[model samples]
Target: MSADQLLDALDPDQREVARALTGPVCVLAGAGTGKTRAITHRIAYGVRTGAYTPTAVLAVTFTARAAGEMRTRLRELDVVGVQARTFHAAALRQLSYFWPKVIGGAPSRILEHKAPVVAEAAARLGLGVDRLSVRDLSSEIEWAKVSLVAPGDYAVAAAAIDRPPPAGYDRTTVARLMEQYEQAKEGRNVIDFEDVLLYLGRILQERRDIAETVRSQYRHFVVDEYQDVSPLQQWLLDQWLGGRTELCVVGDPNQTIYSFTGATPHHLLTFSTTHPGATVVRLVRDYRSTPQVVDLANRMLSRTPAQRRREGGIELIAQRPAGPPVGFTAYGDDEAEAAGIAGRIRRLVAAGTPAREIAVLYRTNAQSAAFEQSLAEAGIGYLVRGGDRFFARREVRDAILLLRGAARARAEEPMVEAVRSVLSSSGWSPDPPSARGAVRERWEALQALVALADDLAAARGGTTLVDLVTELDERAAAQHAPTVDGVTLASLHAAKGLEWDAVFLAGLSEGLMPISLAETDAAVAEERRLLYVGVTRAREHLELSFARARNPGGRAGRKRTRFLDGIWPEEGSGRRRPGAVRGSVLTGEHDPALFEALREWRSRVAAETDKPAWTVLVDATLEAIAELKPASVSELSRVQGIGPAKIDRYGATVLAIVAAHR
Candidate 1:
């Protein structure tokens, strides 16, 4: 494809972003605004136009999967040699290459046995923490280390901030545990995840030659999802840049939801201030969601404080036609919410949307249990998007390795029998672990692997051990599992950069959405951004549901999310009601004043553009526009079928229409 082909799919705003490949450029790309396309094409255009050699540019992503996808896209554009990697992976690679020469014999081993080690440390501290608590502490330690908070200073730092450690544990207790965990890791001759960044940053700062070599190798840098960058990661980026500024960052501050993990939107927010004369572009066109969904998202943000929303917070303008009104469901309890979500998924799949195209998203993984039980009872197949990959699970890997050994000895054995024998020989007991929790979960995973072998063999008409082994090898290489056609179950965080035809956002109650622990204003704002992420994930259909009661108990003291206030329209006023709470219906009521005003403006814009009023803004669309009462041209253009071209032509008149009515 030619260079023009790359720019062909991009809108005018996106094209401008793609073309600006030099200097400091910040793209405040809203959800579904085609940010990935813009960045990828920018790199591609630069490489094709001889402005940049592919190897000289480096793109950093948050996840290895995201980096892989970018590399795939770059390859498709016939642009190879550009390095795309996660920060950890990049650090690990550089550390690995320079370790023997710079530090010593070898770099410290990266911590892999985190849970077990944390459990041991807690035991040593006489803390008696459960497996989950151990894991949470490990996470807390990671956050502290990456945030540059030392163990001795942990208590003070944590107390100074509103964010608390998991399990409501006091900072003093966390500090003690953190110190113990660090000592334990050092004793075990290991370094945790945060150490990767710390080590890389230290080496680069101390070893000028090594830093200079890396900087000379990669002249340009692109960081995606710049909003979720931690301070430590930003420090590493600065070290890599070494004051030579040719950086392009793409992110939406409204989507800054990982503050608890030490990520802040501050870097993205002050990009222009940090790099004076930076090109700051905002992409508001949302091509993923319908007009209705986009309007709801915009309304949600519009209710947020100005500081949280920020200056570059652009309301998304949907390019798709208005679809069905978003469903706001209030359930009697958790069970009802799960059943409601399952029923909706079944109906959507039966109607047309594939099960794979529909996702059930929640605030946390624990919320998956109710939905899982309901979906199973309804005979629905589903996959958890954020769970351990089938091939990557520890038990599954162990089982496969044992199977390989057993299959080598008995090459002619049936695959299922071979799997059974290997599992049995490997001391995999049928009885659950003595202490139930993580161990039991591991055993269950092993049993699942055995069951999978049986199912795969049966499906393939009595396959041999060799075939099963070969299948595992292929799947391990592909980093995918056996194809299980099913609906997707994912947490809101995991559902980022993904879309679904229909999405059911469960557990929208006060405690869950803001997550109870989110106490400070900043933390609460992050929680709201998390929900905004969830809201924008739906492409066509969206169902926001909340249970009145969390458990099987009756509804008592259950309250709706405060964020919903001043967002959902009330019955007759056709305006947001501040006191409106959950379980209240968002009725569609068109105000005569706004409707008349819109009609008048539509007529004027149509006359100026030499087109019919319906062409400028059709009656059905005009009705949606008036009811939505979007305050700006950016928002006015979100009214179905209004793309950038029409926005350029009739946007001013439409905004004046709503302004006159107000």
Candidate 2:
């Protein structure tokens, strides 16, 4: 209830961050150093001490999920009035509020379906841009917009960044496409994602009234992951601050991985230079990853030359106990690599690690195919993060948008019926196309809508269509990094700000980790940092694996990534033998028999209820049940993360498993 009660929960360094109530405070919060906890507690502490009201504090984060988590944490701290928003969310909110009065009666519609629109534009220009190329072009446009480059200046901008167009395309042609894309969107009266910030920045710069209003409303500001702040995003932040110095920004430059999307750590690295009187704090202790994993991350970053420029370089001292030694394994090919990873994941799950707590991280999205196939073959459920966003699918998005529009109009219709009507209007059918592929995928997505309607109806007990639509919007915003129960298959970039109990870094070979696309020295260094990010995602177990051949018909000789030269096992009478895997990844002191029995019971319960094993009981809870050898239902209730609901449901089964094991 007291400020000190919350402050005492943090480490001494973290406690200082929580107590700093005024001025420009910059925290170089390294991975898993409880950065969110520190920032949340700081706001709570200020509110508790009457230094600032909750409404006076504005907490900004890079992602909607992060903002949502911050809001949840603040609420838990009993400080519920703070405004936590992503840059786009906050800007759009203010822009939406002011646009009606300043510009017109209504704000410009945001361009949601950019890829298809861009593809249509390309078709009009008689250019056959494939899906991949369309996605790349969309990215290029986003980069230019965030960089504040005009369509006419896009070619020069691309050249300045030493970035050429995608293969088989020229810069001038791409520039023309970008122009046409803008024209098409303008024709439709829609503004793309980047315009959210651009519009806000323009309004704040031109209109003093709106700026003053926002500045007055939010007197104190805290920004998480300041390293990823784009130039335009930084401009928006400055407008919100309006020369006021009560700003607390936290980020680690080593984790700056979004440079390709116009995000740079420059803003974070130069914060103190801009605000000379800023109080800087460095958090070096890593509480998320084990010593072995932290050591691997440090070793990878230490090899990079530019790491020193980012303030105190990443010297992450692992505060956790020494975990298993880092394991490096070599595979004959991608198939073998995937199989190896799946086998290990299965072993970890069988050893009492929840499937959701294990992750397989790779360099590219394309690399997920083999792993997905392997996991499916191993009967292990896994969720891919990048490029597989369910809500981002075109048909699903169209259906949701239609429902949202109808809901906003306050249509007197049931939400489920509204969903059905929207899907039908969108030309989605109950029966999937006889043929497989895109049509089938769309059909499946629409079917999922029906299922979601039923589930929401059951959960909300006959909620209004408008409320359901609002729920959809909230879910979409907070779904950036949704925690689903499965083996996490994510690209290294997507794996940032996330941690796992056991992580398998696959396709660690040279052309893969640094990917042949990293042409420049800066790009190569970023690639190394990406590796560092992936390594640090592992908390207890870290396994780095590579393959000699990526595909069956690919080249014969495949070398490990140049970044891994020092950390990876060496070949031919070196420190570690080539093609040799190091350390047992499935090491734990818990009784293996009891653990397996608990897992068997969990699987059975999960199947009976059609839920994830973790939903019945997480691996940690199961491990506790096994290790503590709970003799009865009452004893099982004492395990952490197990509550009255779990005790009422699975406690008896868990206790029986323990007794049977004994």
Candidate 3:
């Protein structure tokens, strides 16, 4: 391809980078600012210019979604033959292909969800378990394994940590349980997620031929979201790069939210140290948001004085504060807080926002009930996220069992064993113990529960299994019906990466937020990041509400989160204040006169409902209908906002409405 064609294919900067692709290059481009443009064009240029084969370049991203996007972008640039994959996908593919000769048998079946694994391990060890906390412990083990900590190293490092260790929640028990888990996994002849990287790393170390083959296949590698690369992942990248391959990595250090999962920003921030001659670039312009949102994000960054020189040296400023000042509400109790948020969303949609554009976020899954109830009563549509929203959740399942245990004469051994299996199945237990004594204790306890149930059956006349399960279903229905509306009520962690036009950030209380235990710096920082992620998801209006006492059981110790004090200072000027108490707000009313005027708007909108979203309806068109209230098809199309397309599809109906009102 000639220089002119390259210029036509890409903008000047992207074309320059594309043309300069003979050597390793790092492009630090901000969101939506042509990082894909440069990379894809570079691939196209290399292939077109006869310098490199498309198959020789490898494109990688943090997610499979991103990998698909990259592949599509490259095809648009006419860059062909390149392969794109997520790190996990790539590692597993490589490890599986090589595992036959490297390991004795095929890898263990992947533990897609390891929470159940941890839960079973805990129960076997005889520790009492809470499902929620059990899942979090599983998260800890995942972090360790991804960072390349072997079982031996993990046992040593976890010794000082007071948080329950997974093997058996103690030094010796944990170690033995870990060994048992490994033995079980090996017995199954399947590979878990971490095995993909750990075993792959080992294969590369041992087999020079396989390593060289991978290096040859991917001579030029591009890694997106590079700041998240763990040491183990980095080792795999090293194996692929070897001495022959060129590399480009892009990331935002401040976006390092996955550090708890063994990801580190140090690899991105210190890239120059790793390869002193590598080119580096920083992107400061943010193309994703308005100036108002951008400036507020910048202000938030200044508060992070402790950390500097972020990945790609850019902290996004929302392009602008594109919406209203963040709304803050204080409540004395939990129900009021959840209800308040639901009411705000109701009013927002009434004011013209769509239900799909709104999201309700809370600290924990437990707080979703009141909000769900309120939303349902208000006739709002919603989708809840996280945990088992189905009949299968442990809270619901165990309730069914306890109801059964109370009502029926099921054999105690089977039921107890079933409960243990359910807990393990849900990944909701502490690690189980391996010692004979511990095993005997659980088995004996289960056997004892069976004997006790038998005695209960003899004492209580006519207790039956079917009656108990039936009673349990009715109880489950009673508990589950109130939260049936599809409104998305998600925990803050699961709400990341998703954007909403309107968001309600609820339950921001001190002990509830910092959770009474986040006094340490690391925990506090994580909580802050969680809050930030929650804040950034709102593209339009964002509501922050909290309650001092959640229930009658609430103690007086609860306080407003310290975050509010910083954002909304008592000094009068720092925070925005409402005129009235503004508590318990209901849906806003539409004017009678405006309704008469907008008898015209519905005719046009209903006519266009069958058409494409982007083509048939737009905000500008609706705003125009509100202002002009045109009575005729001629009058409606006569308005500047109503163009040829509007006249074609909606002309006659809009005219009919005009005649009806007249």
> How far does residue 343 in candidate 1 sit from its true spot (Å)?
2.2
Per-model TM against the reference: 0.73, 0.71, 0.68
The 10-residue segment with the lowest total lDDT in model 1? 574-583
Highest TM-score scorer = 1
Give one digit per residue, the lDDT tens place, for model 2 in 31-143.
Answer: 88889989999999999999998888888898889999999998898898899999888888888998887889778888886788889789989998655467767877787
Global Cα lDDT for candidate 1 = 0.76
List residue ranges in candidate 3 displaced over 4 A. 1-52, 100-140, 159-168, 304-307, 310-313, 390-392, 400-487, 552-557, 569-662
Task: Write candidate 1's Cα lDDT for 321-431 as tens digits.
Answer: 556767777777777888988998889888989888889998766566566657766777878788764456655677788887877799887777677778875435666
Residue 35, model 2: Cα distance from true site in angstroms: 0.6
Candidate 3: residue 24 Cα off by (Å):
5.3
RMSD of each: 12.3, 17.3, 14.1
